[model samples]
Target: MKTLLGSQDNWDVVENGHEEPVTTEGYTNAQLNALKVVRAKDKATLYLLYRAVDKSGFEKIANAKSSKEAWDILEKAKNGDERVKQVRLQTLRGEL
Candidate 1:
């Protein structure tokens, strides 16, 4: 299955113990607008694959905070890590 998240998360909102808050208590118009763009981008990326998920599949990613997290969840659930995929490939080659 194709991973929904694109390679690299450029707009990281969360860090060690701090997160970019949606609250704009004392921000200029430009900062607020930029924040809005970041939020929209994050949400849009998350929903890109979310909307395509079937009802049962939706449950697996309903609470994902970012696209990468959601994509990883789906990948892991499908068949496990890269090692597993390589093993499966070898098995199929042998069978054939």
Candidate 2:
């Protein structure tokens, strides 16, 4: 996903922080563009995640404000897979 977004020039919205300063009155044009980019990217990510989620996870994350939040919630709701951990450990030990 990171590579896909980077190729499309939208990776910053998903993976990098927006560093543009905000004012009390409003945002500059560039800042506004950044905001729009982040919002659109977040919504796209959320939609993609939704399609791949189970009913229970969907219900739990339906109201998430952003894709990152939804992903964190979904992760927290899932059980830890010991088999996956063991595989990772085995791979690491092989590298030793």
Candidate 3:
């Protein structure tokens, strides 16, 4: 007598044989974690920028008080501030 295997079992085997697909734009969990760390570093840079500016100026952007906020700030700065632009270039070059 022969035993029969279902399609679901065959699909499972195929899925198991392949590496898990990257969930976000080909980025794995480790890559995402690293990106989070980079965002945190960028946030620190924004904090430094806020310190350089006046208290009120700092508060205006401080509402975005997290890494994502800092990233947005950095993006804006890159467009308007020479220093920030340099930092952004360095970051893209993996030199920061």
| lDDT (Cα, tens digit) per residue for candidate 1, span 2-90 | 34333334334221112358678999999889877777766776676587678766899998887667766777777665778899999
Give the TM-score ranking, best first: 2, 1, 3
For each candidate in turn, the TM-score is 0.54, 0.59, 0.34
**Worst window of 10 by summed lDDT in candidate 1:** 10-19
lDDT of 2 by residue, 12-58 (tens): 55454333335525777896786777777777777776776779778
Full-model lDDT, candidate 3: 0.50
Model 2 clashing residue pairs (backbone) = none
Question: Candidate 2: worst 10 consecutive residues by lDDT?
Answer: 16-25
lDDT for model 1: 0.66
Q: Pick the candidate with the highest lDDT.
A: 2
Q: Pick the candidate with the highest TM-score.
A: 2
* Model 2 residue 80 CA deviation in Å: 5.6
Q: For model 1, state the Cα shift of residue 25 in Å.
A: 2.4
